[model samples]
Target: MEQLKLAARNARKKTIVPVKQVRIGEGFVVIAGPCSVESEEQMLITARMVKEAGADMLRGGAFKPRTSPYAFQGLGLEGLKILEKAGRETGLPVVTEVVDPRDVTWVCEFADVLQIGTRNMQNFALLKEVGKANKPVLLKRGMYSSLKEWLYSIEYILNAGNPHVILCERGIRTFETYTRNTLDISAVPAMKELTHLPIIVDPSHATGRVSMIESMSLAAVSAGADGLLVEVHFKPEIALSDKDQQLNPRQFKQMMWKLRKLVQFHQQLAKQKSPRGET
Candidate 1:
């Protein structure tokens, strides 16, 4: 808790990282795209699909950090170029993961928001590296780290110079193997009490199943998540990475429809409860 000087919970919320016009901490934001940038056509198609469905921003991993060394290690610079192109074409800001400290400076040229994946959540070197960057950051919770640990890691970025830091709860490692990882829904509200930073959820990574993403996403919203980090692909079956969990275009569109209604309801409810929202 002592390590969380800047990121610690306070009476006043700290900051909302701006990704173009999209505000990360102020209201609900949806960031959707393929887990890995597969190709120009794939990224473009998926980007337009999500944009038409009303996503706030786009996410496509340029440098993926996989558990297996033999797996597809992402397209690197090529993927980043494609991601940036899609973002430009669709008028949506881009967010991508940067694994190596050496790549941070150059990667910022392409990405609007820098992402710290679950594995690198506590990599102090990487944390400090991104912290030095001028861009906003999306820091996912470590697979096995506690809330305190996650906040502590975020402090690295803020302490280094960047104040626009967002928290993403992609789930946690637990004994049960039914899901890819256990989605901690409570963390959504807990983070509200633990830090001034906004928290979003990654249902795609949490439950490595297409069947559960919509429900988990709605649950996250209900639990008070500021936004979502979803994996959407034009063709999930043929995706280069995380295919099983990535939402196909049809599913994503349908999910977006439901999410919009839910978001509207939440907004109305909050307005009614707030003194300033009094009619």
Candidate 2:
């Protein structure tokens, strides 16, 4: 069971978008962009394509956390500048990760929604920084963190000041070697019961395969996720980060079509299930 104290704490606070901008009750929100900001052209190309696919928001990592020091880290402030430019051009809200607590101010200046990536879920200091930002925040579960700890992390943000925090189940580390991480579909309904915060799923990172995005996304919405955070690239094979999980423009468009239909059906079902004039 989740700690009700934190849940209650989150309930009384206000959100950045009034629960209507990012997404509505069980309304599917599609957030897509490159896994990491590579260059000006790369970011704009992906953002334009995703916007054309009807994505509700655009996501990209400006300060990526790489396991290997030699791997390409994000473009830092330059990457953020690219994302901002894309958002301006496409009219899609920008979402990106903030790896360090000190960069909170810089990120808030560009990103519409501040993302606390899975690697930074336990960064209490960073969480506090986002908690105080005026923008809405997207918080991902750590690869090794528990559900309880996940909620507590949310508390860390809520207690700090900000309340427009969205939970994202990006998958967790496990013994299985077949996939990058174990996508915890159960976290969807479990989180719903534990808190009113809107929840989203990241199928790209969860399965670490482009082919699995459609099915996992469908399952996520079916499981009651409020939105999806997908990684889209003009050419996934050459993406700077998480190339294996990135979706090409064509694949992303197809998934978006299916998601639109599913969201409509789910909304109809919800209306029918509710008591007359209750919802």
TM-score of each: 0.96, 0.92
Would you list the clashing residue pairs of candidate 1? none
lDDT of model 1, residue 106: 84
Q: Which numbered prediction scores highest in lDDT against the true structure?
A: 1
Candidate 1 TM-score, true structure as reference = 0.96
Q: Model 2: per-residue lDDT, tens digit, 95-169?
A: 899888899988989989899989889999998999999888889999999988898889889888896888899
Candidate 1: clashing residue pairs, number: 0
lDDT of 1 by residue, 119-143 (tens): 9998999999999998999999999
Query: Which one is best on TM-score?
Result: 1
lDDT for 219 in candidate 1 is: 95
lDDT for each candidate structure: 0.92, 0.86
- Give the least accurate 10-residue stretch of model 2, judged by summed lDDT: 11-20
